[model samples]
Target: MNGWSNHLIVAPILVPLVACAILLVIDERRRVAKAMVSLASTIVLTAIAIILFAIESGPSGFEGVYLVGNWAAPFGIVLVLDGLSAMMLLLTALLAVASLVFSFARWHAVGAHFHSMFQVLLMGVNGAFLTGDLFNLFVFFEVMLAASYGLLLHGSGQLRVKAGLHYIAVNLVAALLFLIGVSLIYGTAGTLNMADLAARIPEMEPDRRMLMEAGAGILGVVFLIKAGMWPLCFWLPTAYSAASAPVAGIFAIMSKLGIYVILRLTMLLFVEGPSAGFGAQVLFYGGMATLIFGIIGVLASQALGRVAGYSVLVSSGTLLMVIGINDGAVSSGALLYLVSSTLTISAFFLLIELVERGQDAGANVLAVTMEAYGDAADEEVPEEQGVTMPGTMAVLGICFAACGILLSGLPPLSGFIAKFAMLSAMMGTGAIGVPPTAAIWSLIVLVILSGIAALISMTRAGIRTFWSSIEGTVPRVLVIEILPVMFLLGLTLALTVQAGPAMQYMDATIRTLSKPSLYIDAVRTAAPTGGDVKSSSSEVESN
Candidate 1:
């Protein structure tokens, strides 16, 4: 293998960092030039991610760590590349590409630091996915959140700003919780490297363990907020609805990042600890409530953006519940569901704008203005409709139908396969004598009811927007804008087509995740590759 192959893990983070820096020097008005740079960076990042995914998922692959600044694990920064991180990096790249492409339609130009902030957000997300320690996780989380604040208010509307302020305030509190939790853990356990902490936790003193538990509880609260668990997620729908289309599309992945951390850390740090998911019951019930609450919100949402935002809650809730199930078998399917649902909701966010364009913004003002100005001749021109059915309407309709299928977990798409896999995993093992577990039953019931709610909500929204709106003007959508939506949905279809291989990947991922020993050894004892500094594994013991 080539020497640089060893350094592949860092590329996802560094490539975007460099791109964002270069973009800072460019004039914002040079839209095409800036876009070309951003596009190129995304292409490169995606290529590297695909390569990493293939290598990590392939036979003979093993968990690998890249140490930063020659520092060893438990004491220094390291990036761990495993199935979970590899998949997340690829997912982030794909979303970045689609959102960046869609933004070229107008959102990118409307913002002052669109490209720079977008790339910085990618850097943060990739770093979060790859980091092997809690400290870097917090750092990257802040970076991602900071960039999102600007992106959320990109279009500078009053609603967006108001929601942005609320979003900022909420996250700052979450950040405080995160810091306190990490500090407590580090103070008690003497390390923050997840794998090392996993090793040390099983042997900690009781008083320190009690302290750690309190800290971990606070951390779980923070994650639930980030993951959009119910009640804590009251800020989500409004904030997301207020963002511009492309920005909101990328933000779909943000909540899932929180879910990923919870899943990853719970599997690693708490798998063998005495407490073993101390607050898991809360997560399970909270997730159920979140799913139910999201369904109700979806039903009540009058705007398409609000529905998309609430759908994020649905996806997060489902994953949280699945993770809380604490079964490695069910988790495999949950991972699949996570990928499909995130892609679907992102496509939904982008589709909402295109779908709403033709709807009356406020009283169909252009026609009224024309009539009021006594421009009777202008109104008499009978407003050209290109053909019997406009192409834009047809394209938007097709995309909307696909999003509905994916979101509702309907057939012939990955959503159905993912949900079905999860259901089978949950129910297949019900014993002959014992009543079904409450958690399992609740999961089953909520999953079904949520789907039904999504179906009804999408139907009503579709009918109002598509069927009854024949008199509404045809939306003018550019090919660039529409293509991103199609690409995202197409990826979901591809997931459906390759369900066999995808499931196998998830199976492997779950197996690795459930065993903290492998992760611990890889980080604390494994030899460093890439540009990482070499150090002794024994440092973990001393540290």
Candidate 2:
């Protein structure tokens, strides 16, 4: 049992891959089989994540690295199960399961292979989370990207195809840059393993140091592109809006992939000293810009889908800002925000799809009702085919309110907890320097402004759609369609109840990340060579 527990680190990664493989072989017409595969895999993955979290909660503080084939670091593959990875794995599992549940009825609406592609995408995301090698990160990233390519255009309409092209072009460039950066790092350090590279980084020659920094900087840009940071996020709203509802819901979580890697690499490998790196300033500025753009875009857009897409851009910006701030409190806050915002946004997206569909089916029913009531006097009656039910409108209203409040960091919500944590971190008694102070303040203002914009737009839309007089009978919302939204609401409430423990866990995770020597030592000791890598181990000490 102990041996099995120690090997649990690989399960999160393997479960999804195995599920994907099984899904690929299943008959697409066998919807039951596909749903079972997805649900069972997600449940098992979530269970494993919870178990790992409990195991890491013990006095040791981390589960340590799980080396594949007993190969030591700097040579063999490894998967590190630290606090960050465990938390992320758990969050991803939760969201994935929620998404799968939402898709129970809607999967066929999208297509036959939708579930298969979804599982493949999950495989990529989970693999990325568990990988301890930088090169493997690239492989997982590409895996996710390829699956996304299929999912994004699953419906294959003109708009989707066009939007997907833009998404593909941008990500391809980012992937190339990522590969180039990794090659440079490997060429200079003579190793591709994260732990070993961190140990060797401080001892590199001056020129080599500059080369690696350049590579890291380029790599940072690649992640920023993935994270939808300013100037690079132009394609996000369009592509996401054009995707099928379920695919869009899943993609909302996908944007976090870049930020996750940035957080991991920045703290674990790049935190040598102030003079040793460019700091997180670039990320901060980019995030702030992206936030502003997203707010403006949200306000400018009328369609619910596009509005939600822009909101995602804004959330991504805030997340990157927190990462760039690089304080333990800030990072913890970001993690909290990341998990909450993703759920809220995903729920919102799912709700939008339901509303859109229901509206289409209820338009005529609503038009007739409006004619009978004679309330159509001043209003432009919606096309009979486009009207939606009151119940569907109510659910949409609730989801929008939740998403807006949570995304904007309002009090008594998960988003607020995350924001407050970040604000506390940013105000940390001069730790971030004067420049950072200005940046932090700017971010705070941006967050408030964006929230206000979102509130106004969403409220206006909700009032017009839900409260205003309509001519037709409301459409019925399927239980499966509403289940995911309710689950997300419960999650948001749970976050509030468990805020204390959640924050503590995030803090501990950040602290563990801030001190990588403990991680390096663990890997060294656990290596098959049994701490034989003296130079690498000692180099970390000097740093």
Candidate 3:
């Protein structure tokens, strides 16, 4: 494969956008057309990701950069393909396909627009991952947000509408702040390209540097808000709970976008000078707070949907904490955890929806009575009368167990691999700035406690849903319902079995991320004009 082939980078993004366009023109009622387009596009995207990964992992070990339109960096748009972007793209493709499969049976209950919006959202997400410019990142964020608006309110129920409105309002504010931050940086640095900005930022004046730091600080808050960080994430649970199962699963991917950008930019562009160490502090404290809030939310929530929502919050917190530590090894672990938790939580949400549907069906059927004379009847249906489909229960049980295991970080699972990686990295001295003393031990203790809390809460909920007897017999599970859980669980197991390659991939990704020069060289060398600029710490600090 040609290293400079921009199509490899662009295909994953364009395919989905093109599919969304084609889906819009087709008849809305044609389910076959929708499924064909979605599934085909997903497969193509996944294949493209795999190809890109293979090419990068070839004898050269890494493909540095693939410039877009043969234009040089600091002037023309660039698309840099390295470890981080590849890993993110692969994960997004995999999860998007899984979520789409999960939605197959519920398509009729939702609508054609549901699937259309989903493809659009995927396009935005992939584009965000591949783009090398900050402005393009914001554009993709808006695209995804727009699609989410429709998906969040696909059913148009009162609760969905209310939740959607809140979600929109909060994210719009975050978007506005994001733009402001971009403008501040552009005004100070005269460029929006991440590579160029990084190269030029180190030479900036002290005051200007402080201003850039302030701007970055504000921008970090916006990302934290998007990631559902503590104190600012109150809207996530309500909004996520109200969305349809597939929509919620898709939404799960959205939060990671903000975190990914934060990690990428902070480590690459922001960690060059005196202020390099400060952001980590923010991440650490924010993570701890977010973790506490999530646990409290889980303890307080009674509904299944809300509990899953809280789990997302906790996971996001944990990720931030790992990132804040600034250890590549730990970051790799967090990356793995992010992928595993995403799948498990999404499966759990789907299972909750199934349980809700079964209960609702039974309640509705029992609420009314048939009569020959057509007289009004006032017989009330017991809430516990819903039949538990054995197949559905079995699948839900498996999904719930997967969720519990992932949350608890048990052995032989992806979560375990991820946690073990972080622990190993932490145990090694000189890996992070934090001293290896009682304080570090305390931090580890807190993390363990959080994991235990999540495990206990999730286990209790699983027992109630899967093992406890209701008033009626178990309902039959639809094949469609079981498909998503099976697929996700299978993937999780595969990750466990093939931990070596995956870890190698993650380590390679971390190495690439840690070294921004590889990315810079690719863009600079690929530029048609051959004007290469070296990044300076002072310039980055000022910008």
Clashing residue pairs found in predicted model 1 = 70-533
Query: What is candidate 3's lDDT per residue for 118-219, written digit by digit as tens?
Result: 888988998888888888888888898899888988878899999999999998999899988988888777778887767666767888877777777877
TM-score of 2: 0.89
TM for every model, in the order presented, reads 0.93, 0.89, 0.88
Q: Write the per-residue lDDT of candidate 1 for residues 1-543, one digit (tens) a residue.
A: 235676898899999999999999999889899999999999999999999998897333354678787577667798889898899899988998999999999888986989999999999999999998899999999999999989998889789999999999999999999999988988898788888788888788889999988888888888889899988999999999999988988898899998999898888877776868866788788999999999999887767888888899998899888887898778999999999998999889889888888887642344344446966454334455654667788788888888888888899899999999999888777744556688899899989888888898888777767754635788888999999999999999999999999999999889888878888877776544434535544654655
User: Any runs in candidate 3 off by more than 4 Å, and if so which?
Assistant: 1-5, 58-64, 360-392, 430-439, 529-543
- Inter-residue clash pairs, candidate 2: 363-384, 363-387, 364-384, 365-472, 366-471, 366-472, 369-471, 370-471, 389-474, 389-475
lDDT of each: 0.86, 0.78, 0.76
Task: List residue ranges in candidate 2 displaced over 4 A.
Answer: 360-392, 425-436, 469-473, 529-543
Stretches off by above 4 angstroms in model 1 are 58-61, 362-388, 431-435, 528-543
- What is the overall TM-score of model 3 with all chains considered together? 0.88
lDDT of 3 at 123: 88
